[model samples]
Target: MKPADSAAVALLGLTVLGLAAPTAAAQVEPDPMVAGQRVRISDGRRCAQDGAARVSSRLFGPVVLRPGEGGMAAQARVAEGAAPGRYPVTIHCASGGASFTETVTVRDARVEGLNAAQAAGGLALLALAAGAAFWLRRTVGGRS
Candidate 1:
């Protein structure tokens, strides 16, 4: 092959490799979960130290990250009553002070429909109040 042709082939190979290989930006992963749901993440990067690993969010709670296998596993529970929306997740790597941030979406549980337990409880409370009111009216009115 000609020198120029060889150069072109090398450039093409580099471009293909660049597209095929996953970059650092692609390594960070985001897991989406509903309110009160648990999400697990498996990360392959090792941090600087044990205490250096951290994840945080305001809507939910702190992420419990543990070293496992060749990487790390993170467990985070979404707040039971957290409002449906996108929340920011911040991950702190123990090594090199590197941080990663991603957004997780929380879908409203109520969006599906009314919860049976909540509806039943509300109805029961309403009936009890009505019965108490009837009793009060009968007694205070001096009626049988």
Candidate 2:
């Protein structure tokens, strides 16, 4: 093959590969978010420069996105009644008419509360405080 023709074929191959490459994906911070908590959505592709991008999820209704560092960002509150499970969140960019979906896991708010270990720690602290108080009373009262 002619050197020039080979160069053209190489360029075409690179072009095809570039076009087929996947774009950066959108992301939700604080994965395994608790119901009713606010979550930040970040668009890694910066596709919302036109200021018409939107994000939506079953757990949280449509949220209008605004330009943010690194890309676009938006905050949405998970419904208080959202069930504990994984839900798909989609970001639609009006500029390129491109949409990306990311899965977000919603956890029950109860999970945010103290667990068994924490409860045990609290109980231990309480008992120690009570014991200290009793000892102080016994020593001071006897001296009196």
Candidate 3:
């Protein structure tokens, strides 16, 4: 291929990769429970948040993470027919940055969803408050 053609192809390839990289990396379904909650975590290149203004790709692995790429956990991953152990996840993001991880003791254990525990606790509190309101209304009406 001609030099110009090769350059054009390379540019096209980079453009495609740029478009797809964010979709592939740091794409965790927004869990309201986890969002804005400061859980102990690490950052990586995949740390590019959804709808972020700037994103930086990174490597996730066992090593001290620093500012920039090749740093923290990008997203969750489980490969087919791969050996099991804690692997590093790296990420880099302009909007926000994070670096940390949880142990994958069992494969396919991490499912995305709201926390049942938090939801249940919130519901219980609401119930108790409702019961109290009913009791107060009854007492006030009887006194009047």
Candidate 4:
């Protein structure tokens, strides 16, 4: 092969290897989490051997992260009044390791239509009204 062609091949191989290199990333489980719910954040790389790392976000506030299987894991409870939107979560290692950001989605807990409790209550009221009508009909008819 020509020198120029070999050089080009080497450059292409290097570029591919660089692109395939693994990078430390952070991710949140249960992407669309309801407000007041807890979510698990997983770290792709372990933090330095120092104190605990800090995980903070507008939805969940600051939480101390600990090293777990595969990487660091922490559970954060989203605020009860968090608005329905996407929030950025940040993980800062204690010993100045790489910091990464991940996004978490928060959704309103209340459903748009009637919920189970409301449906049950409505059924109870309906039954009571039916019973009252039956009693009135029986009593008035018997008297007449």
Q: Which is better, 2 or 4, measured by lDDT?
A: 2
Q: Which ten residues in a row have the lowest lDDT in candidate 4?
A: 2-11
How many clashes does each candidate structure show, in the order listed?
A: 2, 0, 29, 0
Best by TM-score: 2
Candidate 1 lands at a TM-score of 0.49
Off by over 4 Å in 3: 1-60, 63-110
RMSD to the true structure for each prediction, in A, is 26.3, 22.6, 22.3, 24.5
**Candidate 2 residue pairs in clash (backbone atoms < 3 Å):** none
Expressed as tens digits, the lDDT of each residue in 38-92 for candidate 3 is: 2222342444434232322222222232333443322322334334333333333
What does the lDDT come to for candidate 4? 0.73
- Candidate 4 to truth, TM: 0.55
Rank candidates, lDDT, best first. Answer: 2, 4, 1, 3
Give per-residue CA lDDT, model 2, range 6-106, as digits (tens): 54575567568758988549788767688888888887765747676888778888798888666888888889888889999888887667888888778
lDDT of 1 by residue, 54-124 (tens): 67677556665567664656666667888878777666776546776667667765244455666896786
lDDT of each: 0.59, 0.76, 0.39, 0.73
What lDDT would candidate 1 get against the real structure? 0.59
lDDT of 4 by residue, 3-118 (tens): 34454575567568758988547777766688888778877665764567888788877788887775777888888889998888888888787788987667676435665667
The lDDT leader among the candidates is 2
> Which 10-residue window of candidate 1 scores lowest in summed lDDT?
23-32
- If the candidates were sorted by their TM-score against the true structure, best first, what order would they fall in? 2, 4, 1, 3
